[model samples]
Target: MREAGKTLDAALGEQAGLQPTATILKVIQLTQQHRGLSALVLGGVEGVKDKREAKQKEVDEAYEKFDALVKDFNNKAIDDAWATPKREWQDLRNRISSGAITVPESYTAHTALIPKLLVVNDLTSDLFGLSLDPDVDTYQLIQSMYYQLPYLTEETGKMRAKGAGLLAKHEATLEDRQVLAAIIGRVNDRLTQTHTALNKAFVANPALRDKLEAQWQSAYDLTNKVMQLANTHIVRPETLEFPGTEYVAQTTAAIDAQFAVNQAASRQLEIMLNDKVSDLRKTRWIMIGAMAGLIALAGLLARLIARSVSMPLQQAVHISERIAQGDLTAQIDTGGSSETAQLMRALKAMNDSLVSIVSSVRGSINAIGEASNDISTGNADLSSRTEAQASNLEETAASMEQITATVRNSAEHAREADQLVGSATSVAARGGQVVAQVVDTMGAINDSSRRIVDIISVIDGIAFQTNILALNAAVEAARAGEQGRGFAVVASEVRSLAQRSASAAKEIKELITDSVQKVEAGNALASEAGKAMHDVVASVERITGIMAGIMMAAQEQSTGIEQVNQAISQIDEMTQQNAALVEQAAAASESLQQQAATLQDAVAVFTLHERDAGYSYQSPAQLTPRKLSLVSINGIA
Candidate 1:
């Protein structure tokens, strides 16, 4: 029972350890299943980020290309808005003064300025859309730069176109000069506004300042040239030359600044995305490592628990095997306060009980053997006396003339024979009682043997259960995989121990079963012996009745003596048969004694602490007394 408890505890502990691990494993599997989805989400984020980066690059390239286009148009506009108008007016002034061209012809030449003026306005409009597209309100310098700068450029172009058109009449009129003067004033106003706005943009966005300063100077110089040309109105000196190379440098720097701003924003975004991806990868590996560590720890704990439980049980099983083999000398140390310890204690106690019972039974058998010897001695004496009587009766019959004396002698002998026969009947009755008691004792022994079988059966059941538990532990260990291999070996060893225990229990059970069968056979033999003793008593009673008849008929002495001789012969024959039966009974008792010795030897393997006094007994009369007395008188003890 205690062993079973230990096995059950171990089983429960194993299951307890495995259940959580199984749950954790299931949870890990569930989480791992989601890993793919999580990876997909991360991949999607990366894809979107990549796409955004690509789109940003495309936008940057397009903006740079557009800025270059604006730079080209801006360069042309500067020439047309300022340098072109100045050079044409100076030519006209020289032609009129030197008298090479008429005033009307100069007027027709002034029409040439109209087309350049219109081209300058077109360049200003294109700059607004390409380089200075409005994003914020006009309050911001960036927006004001786009709006006001283009407005100033367009106003300058218009001023040039108007001044040239008004002066192109056949005669120079006061009204035409007045209109041209107004145009010059407006152009100066726009130039001042454009310069102020450009300076503000440089201040607000300092990154563009270095590059914008040069362009601002170029535009300022162009404004001054346009103002000079407008003041003369086809009358300036021929010092006017288009500043085309300076205009190109300013436009290039402006375009480069805008492209640089776009590239910086895109690069910053790409760096942030790269950092985010790196952090996510680190986090993923960390999670995977943590999960693996937890699983390893759980497996380690399970292995430790399995070893702790299995080792002690193996020791207990070894001890139990010795006990089953009738080797009670085997002792076990219960290592600690565990179920296996309790089992060891229980087995020790059972061993002690068996030793006491075996010792007591040995004592009882010895006592019974002594009583059988006494019965055999008494039976031998009775057989001798009967033979003596038969010889004397035959001698008296040989002298028929001494018939009267012989008749009286025969009557006296008949009374003595009747008394002896009554004694024999009393002895036979006692022997029958003894045999009945022996039958009862044998029956009791059979019952005890049966009980021992039952105890063995219980042990077998415990072994079987332990075997099942070990098998279960092995299966759990197998499920634990590589980490569980150590536990699996332990479980296998435990299973082997259980099997050995079961085998020992089975052998003990078989021994007990055989013992019970022998006991039952002994009981049946004892019962038969009791019935035989009763028949012996009946035969003795018949002899006693015939003896009484001989005492009553003394006058027919010869006839009675003849009958007496026949009865004596019959008594002698019966006495000889009783002697044979006594010998058989003594032989049976000796055989029983040998069986008891064998039983003692079988149990002698055990080392007992103390010997118990054998079982109590009744007086001989109460315990197979009939067989005792029958053997006592039959000259066989």
Candidate 2:
């Protein structure tokens, strides 16, 4: 059906091409007329300028129609093929209108452009699929319209221009006669080809003959008259006497006649193509209707077949749904031995198995709930005991910590005391050394005091001698009268000074003796004190050694107590972890009990028998075991 639609579309597309082809043919005819009339006017013939202008207008109008049709086609090949001839036509028309083209040049230009126009016509036919028409009738008609009639019209146009040029000039050269003769021969040949093509079209579709035969004969007669007139008056004689206007009129009539045949053939081609498209469309619709009927029939049969299979399957599905919803008591009708019936029997067996499994699972759920509850209770008690043990261990650890701190402090104090005793011993030893030096210095000072006493006695003896000498000097001075009396006063003062010096020497000797005695006493005391300081240094050294031993013992004791405290703390941590584990176990057991209760409730939805002796319930150990996660201990993930 789809292929038929495409065929219909192609037929319609071909039908759409007909109008453009007709417009191109019309443009060909008008341009050919304008060509002949322009040749006549350019040959200096009278009364053809307006005719040429009017024919130009008609050509222009035909070009406009052709352009409009080409636009509809949107074929680049058609547009490109037409461009040269259209430009040439405009140039030729302008040259003729402006009197810039001689008759020969005008005629040559028109002659050159006509074949290009014919080429465009052929291209337009091919574009529209007219040249490739598959049907015998349309193909024959297209040959005539696209080739034969256009060729005949062009030949007639050439004859018209050549004969009209000769008649307009009122003279015929040998070259002009030969050209007219050649054109006449071509016209006859084209006329023959056109006849043969029309005859074949008539044979292919006799109705075309009945419709277009009269116009075909009229065009044939007119073309024959034009060809005869050209041969008799223009080609055979050196002098031309026929009126150029009448020749042009007669030749144009003949060309128009051929165009009328061309137009008739085109109309018939359009009718045939339209009719073909209409037939294809009808056939497409008929095929569509037939396919639709077949589809409907197939659908009906499918529906009936689906009911046969789906009805039983739907019943099985309904039973399965009831079983899925835990309604195991749904009735099963396993009547037939078909696949559907087997499915029904299978569902029935599944339902019966579920009834038994549900009963077993219910019993299992009850046992699990009771066991979990007892386990939960036991875990709770174990958790409480573990918590209490952990607390006691923590308190013991705290006390041990305090004892360890005290021992550490005692050790520290003993170390400080030992250091103080060591320092005191050093100071005492230094004091003993200083005391021994002081005793030696006291002995040396006593010797120096004895020397001072001896020196004082010698000074006393010297003062006595000085006093005796002074007394002798005083007697002598008395014997010498007044001079001696002055000397006597000096002797008395010297004697008094000598006595005071002796007394002073005696007092200094006594004081030095007293100092020596005191120095001796101080030396004895220093010797005793030095011995006492030496004894004190020895005692302090012994006390320092004792304190060092005490400090070492205290440090060892403190380290032992700290180790014990660490052990207690570790034990406390272990107890704490044990308590947490017990609590987690209790919680897990409680959750297990709740889940067991939930499972029991969930299974309660199924209706089951009181007992099933055929199937035995499996124990948890005998059944598949689920994977369990181990609780983390001591932060090990």
Candidate 3:
């Protein structure tokens, strides 16, 4: 009975059921009774039966209370605390997480939920405060039924309201839905933890198996029903809808089915217990009838019991041993409807699961190994390419540096040429000035020659007049004869003198005309020279402008070359960095390959299914270096 109780506890505990919680209460009560399993066995079978019934009643009453609380929560408290909030919250969450609404829209939805401040306040301060506690017990279930569930519902309602607002404005988003999903998940986790605690309590007790199972079923059903309702409330039909509610319903159904299975197991256990009780009664009667025959019959019964139990147990142990050695193909033959048969079946199932897992892991590891090898190969190729690129960039940068220096030199020479042209222009301008002064001097000389010519003409005119006056005196002297002869001779001599004076004046005038002509010619030559000088100055100025342009162009070229060189240098640096990154990537790939190998070795202990029998593993040689085609990158040349 004790072993049966322990087995039941183990099974119920694994399910994280309510039976575990009741089992704890029963254990606490049993300890107070100070009755060991041996005492219960030595005591009358009626006493064991009585204890079982009493415990069953107590457990049934506890379940009845839990069921009543669930009914109240479902009928009344859930509508106010859970339904509205869960509906609203889930709707909003769905919209956000489904990518229908943006973060800002979600915020707007949150703001919209503020109108439900009363609900939020009630959920936080009243329902949550009352429902959730630090300890796990029947009270915990009560709290969950009265407060926690209601709070979750109210919260969901608030979220749903937010979703509705979001849907009105924007579409739902995956992120928003995730956020809401996380909230729901977090709230649901509390229930999961409570369930886990109950399972632990169940595992700690061996007595009160029936009581615990009933209590667990009731509590599990109630909680699952409330969860389903809450989930349904959270579904938004109008906006972004999800199968969250349907999924919860399915989960509840599955759990219900599991509970049914447990009940069946319990029934089987009860039948076995009845059989044992019947045997005990028969044994007691036999002892009462014949004391001598009782001992002999007892020995015979013990032998039969050992043979019936030990043979199957030994076979099960052998199968388990083979399974432990990674032999999943080991066949089990625990040929009875006994607990040993059940255990063997469970072990077989476990072996099947292991086989599936190992096959999956093997495939995954092989894929990983191949991927790591590919990555390593790709990284190596990339590294070599990066190195080549770096070398090319370095060469290009060197070439650009030389070009920059050459351009700089050209600029300097252009500047020097510009300066020289400027100097030549200045010299030409000075020559133009000198020619202008010479032109002015020639003009002054031409003016003086003209004045001299004019004075000579005046003198010539005077001489001519003198000659005419001499002729008139000579005629007066001839008429007066000898007395006038002296006067006539004076007039003739004066006329002769005037003629000489006229000849001299003509010569002087001719000389002055020649001098003036020469001066005018010199002035023309000087003006032409000055013009030539001005042309030279202008030409020199043009040359200077050209030189200046050349200097500017050369300077610009030098600057451009410098910039190109700098850019090339930067490219070289980046290429070097890329090479380093590639190297690091190669190392990482190698590490990943090692890890994949290790994983492959780890799962080698498990036997794979026949379907995976032909699985082939990659060799390390496949990960090694291979001849690769080189690709040339263009440089800045």
Candidate 4:
């Protein structure tokens, strides 16, 4: 029973309805049967880690879905249903969905009572509109009564209560209604004063205040007519025109039908409960039998295990104690059990292994002494070899010094040759005159681009002025008379043309300005590169002049000392700066080649066919617009 209670608590703590109670009962029964399954899962169930992680994920997903369902219920069911139906049904259902209400012991249990704020029977369809269902279940029936009140008081009523009459605190009974009637009298007097003021407003502003007075007349007429209609409605239906009052009978019938369903559900649930209880009784008996069988089996296994295990364990202990007392000569009898005989054999093996281990240790000590003497002889040999290696190392060091000096001179000559080769290559590949011409052209193009940007700026300014002029022209055209109609038409056409021209010109100017700036910047970069190339050429020439003197000095040093001459000769250089320039030029050419290869990729991203133009295009800049933009002569477009 305690186990069942725990299961029930787990399942139904936050659950709802008679259905949920049934579910909880089933869970309890399942738990009782499966008793230690949860322990087994923790112990080592197959795929336990995956199952646990999946279940946790399911639980989190359930929380999110449940939250969404509640929000949906509030938006779709609660707020919407309240607005459409005066019944408390929607709000009650919302509470159930939101987990705000406890699960009912019986599904139809909650609707038995309602707050007095809801005048359930006295409701009008106009105030709390009809539910689509003529008869509702307990949940829906409850919602029907909630919408009626103080509940369905129109916004106008709240507004009236908020006015100077202070109807909110009036507590309108027959006494307060009398006060309200007095307040209404005072309201009418205020209306008279307002009527005068509104009439004066018409005198002050005829067009506007006349509309206000019209609204006042309509509102006052409607209010008086409504009061009269209400009185007539209270007096006799024959004097009233409203035809839908018969729905009251329909509503009562609906409430009755709802009550009938509740009673039926309640009775049906009782029957289901009785059947469940009967099944549970049978289950309890089964559980007791199962428990008895388990207990009996446990006793039998314990008895069997004791006879098999304890005797062997005690015998093994005795043998172990005897061995512990230094009984090296002691022997154990196996009594024909292979496992027991194996233990005896293991003991004998241990004794033999220990004696052998002692003999092996003595041999190892004698061998270690011999190995120490051998190590001493090896160390003497190693020291003799190391002394010879040190002498060779000194010779290697001198060779390395000579090699270092040779590499340094070779590096210098290579640097000079590299520069000269690069300059020669550029001159051969592209003539010096052509290079100078290109540089001069770039400069001229750069100046022309600057002028183009200025022209674009002037055009933009003109467009702005033209727009202003068009606006003024339009206003002038509006003021023109019939005699000036032809002139006005001309002015209107001019204004339209001016607006079109201005917009087109502005767009064109922006395009021109961007192009000009790009060209000017490209020119400046080209000019700087040309100057760098020129400086490299001059530096290479200076190095070539220094190389001759270096070679002559090395020859004189050779006569002074032969070894030092080899070191000085290491200063000889072969290549110069022209080689480095050639490499850079090659690198730039390679980049240009790769860029040409991807021209097809550029075309792939843009669909010329879809553009319905000469070409479909998007700027690379569009991919990362904020990545630093070029500062045009103007500003950002």
| Structural similarity to truth (TM-score) of each candidate | 0.24, 0.49, 0.37, 0.23
Candidate 3 Cα misplacement greater than 4 A, ranges: 1-375, 392-429, 469-488, 539-566, 591-633
Model 3 TM: 0.37
Positional deviation of residue 484's Cα in model 1 after best superposition, in angstroms: 3.3
Per-model CA lDDT versus the true structure = 0.54, 0.81, 0.57, 0.41
Reference-based lDDT, residue 420, model 4: 70
Find the 10 residues in a row with the least total lDDT in model 2.
613-622
lDDT digits (tens) for residues 1-637 of candidate 1: 3443443343333222222222222222222212212222222222333432343344334334333443444465444454564456456434533547543354345445434533443444343332232312112343333334434544444444333333322233565556656756765776677566656655655644565566556556766665665555333322323222232223223323322332332232233334434554555567668768988998998798778768877877887787777666666675567776787777767777776676776577557655655555555555565466556545644544366567878778887888998899899989988888898899888988988888888888998998899899889989999888899899899889989989999999888888888888888888888888988888888888887887766547767666766675666567667657767766775576556556656555655544343443333334443322433434423
Pull out the clashing pairs in model 2: 477-484
Q: Model 3 clash tally?
A: 39
What does the lDDT read for residue 413 in candidate 1?
Answer: 82
Every model: Cα RMSD to truth: 53.2, 14.5, 32.4, 50.8
Q: Identify the superior model by lDDT, candidate 3 or candidate 4.
A: 3
> Lowest summed lDDT over 10 consecutive residues: which window, candidate 3?
30-39
- What is the per-residue lDDT of model 4 for residues 443-521, given as tens digits with 9 covering 90 to 100? 7876776787677667667766766776676667667766566766776676677677767767876877777677777
Candidates ranked, most accurate by TM-score first? 2, 3, 1, 4
Cand. 1 TM to true fold:
0.24
Candidate achieving higher TM-score, 1 or 3:
3
Model 1 misses residue 60 by how many Å?
Answer: 99
**Candidate 2 ranges beyond 4 A from true positions:** 307-637
